[model samples]
Target: MAISEIQSVAERPEGNELAGRVALVTGGTRGIGAAICRALAGHGASVAAGFSHDRERAEAFRAELAAGGADVTLHRGNVSSAEDCRRTVQEVVDAHGQIDILVNNAGITMDRIVSKMADADWYDVIGVNLSGTFFMSKAALEHMLERGSGRIINISSIIGQTGNVGQANYAASKSGLFGLTMSLAKEAAFSLKRAGRLEAYGAGITVNAVAPGFIETEMLDSVPEKALERIRSEVPLHRLGRPEEVARVVRFLAADASSYITGQVWAINGGQEM
Candidate 1:
């Protein structure tokens, strides 16, 4: 489907499933991240969208959400830095009261064959993609744990699971998230247990990852045309996945409907990896 049509579709058709929730999405100004912000906002969640740069895109994101009457606020910060992540979280908490949901969607790629990959390239990708997730998750954990609940959803990738030829650093960072997800999930479980609130897996809080493959986002623009065609041909659906499709999965995980689940990696690929 065309992106415009996907954009027009109802992001929260389940009827305010996430009412009274507050969500922070990093790298939320464009592409999959933007779609996630709109989806969460549409579901009745007050959204705090974090962007490192690109003021024009950030303004447009605000406008899009405003047009739909979504409670979305824009926050500017670099996810790769611990201080910025903490500041961003605090600013949102101070304004919105609490962080009910955290979407670690901010990521970057400095692609190159491992042999030729510069040290800076590797560190840059790892810092933003992996370390950013850690920083944001840690910062938001304070409020979430105190409230006795939360949903931390990390945006991973197919490349992270199935190795990509020219993305060693990216793959490693994404793979690291799986371990992080499980560790955090169990930590939350035990912490709640210590507080004598040993409820079901999702009752206390949930930490999960959503890995997408070949989605229609600006990130794909960097791919060679032939490679993009190859990806499309491999997908059983014969097309790249839309950002909305991934956002819907995120919306579900954020809502009470997904309370019974946590620490799972949900793939949004069109059968590309499977």
Candidate 2:
């Protein structure tokens, strides 16, 4: 499908359910991350779009969204750095006054066979994909726990679920999100309970993961056409997933209606796994 065919948020009829909320999305300037930003902002959330580099692209994205009447700001920093993650989170809160949603979508790939992978390859992928999620989540959780409400969405990958060749480091980092999501969910619950803020009617802090499969994004552009065809054939749907498809799910998980759901991984792979 042409990118133009994907429906814009303005085209949708849903309510502005996210009005007044603020969202911080790491790696939010392009591809799936960009789509996620559009989804949230389209629903009326103030968006903080985080990008590590490529200032021109980031600015263009902001301009496009701003022209569409979306409230968005650009935050630049490397998610791999703990201090950078902390500072990014702080900057979001400082600019937006509060953070109601945090999407740990920033990640990197240092793909190679286990034996051939460099130490930097393994550590770099783990640092950004796993530790970055931890650092950002911890910073956001501090503020979320105080308020007794928030959402933390981690973007894992299908490769994490069904490991792929030449992706040992990537797989380890992505799969690790499951443990972190569940653990943080439990910790959030315990903290809320200890604070006497875990009311039956209210939705307290929640943490979850969304794993996407074979999405049509620039990340896959380097793959040869024949390989892409093989991947498409492997999917039951016989088509590559769209970035917006992933974004829609992320938006759903971010909403108040999803308050009861937490500590679970939501797969958007078009029956590729099951």
Candidate 3:
């Protein structure tokens, strides 16, 4: 099937029965994160979207989703801080009772070669991408384990797998996320088995990652048109990916339809890896 036409198997099975599930999407005020929030809400999952510093933008997003009749709440917090991650997760649980899905989508890029990279830049990127995922996952796992069911989908990148020229920090952080996914998947399974809920979550709480490439978002707006055109030409599909395209993959992983999958990275790069 064509990439754009690939629909997640989850939505097809549950239909609208997802009404009671709660989802949290970090950095969800805009771009790919926003798309993920919208798609999940549309499918009946109550969504909580997080933003770092843009109160106005975050409020606006809440209003937009609400206007469309989506059960969405906005939370302001920096994912890099463990305190913020804890607070955000608490807010979601407080409002919704439990968190069924957690999307670790907040990340920042400080593109520079290793030789030219500043200590501050390296630290900042690692703090947000690697440490942030760790903190959020740790916080969310508590609730997921108690409930014996949940989904954690980390947003990684093609650059993480196939090294990029000027993103050593980004590549390392994303590569680390893959390792985190595997370890957590094993831990989650063990915990479920101990709780005697092994079958309940044999496919119950799956942790996965979605790696995207050359997506069209504000991050790439600065690229010259010529450069973007060249990138599109190189892709096997000859196109830059849309944020919604990545969001669909996230929606699938978050839903029960993906019950049997975990610790896997779904690359939405239009064959770039091949």
lDDT measured at residue 46 in model 2 versus the true structure, 0 to 100: 93
Tell me the RMSD of model 1 versus the true structure: 6.8
Q: Where does candidate 3 stray beyond 4 Å?
A: 1-17, 200-203
Task: Judging by lDDT against the true structure, name the best candidate.
Answer: 2
Give all TM-scores, in the order shown: 0.93, 0.94, 0.93
Q: Per-prediction count of colliding residue pairs? A: 0, 0, 1
Candidate 2 structure, TM-score to reference: 0.94
Query: Tens-digit lDDT track for model 2 on 1-274?
Result: 2334333322334658788889999999999999999999999999999998999999999999999999999999988888998898899999999999999998888778989999999989999999999999999999999888999999999998999999999999999999999999999999999998986646578899999999998889889999999998888999999989999989988877677899999999988887
Candidate 1 local lDDT, 70-131, one digit each (tens): 88889999888999999999999998999999999999988899899999999999999999
RMSD to truth, every model: 6.8, 6.8, 5.0
Candidate 1, pairs of clashing residues: none
Q: Tell me the whole-model lDDT of each prediction, alpha carbons only.
A: 0.88, 0.91, 0.89
In model 1, the runs with Cα more than 4 Å from the true position are 1-13, 200-202
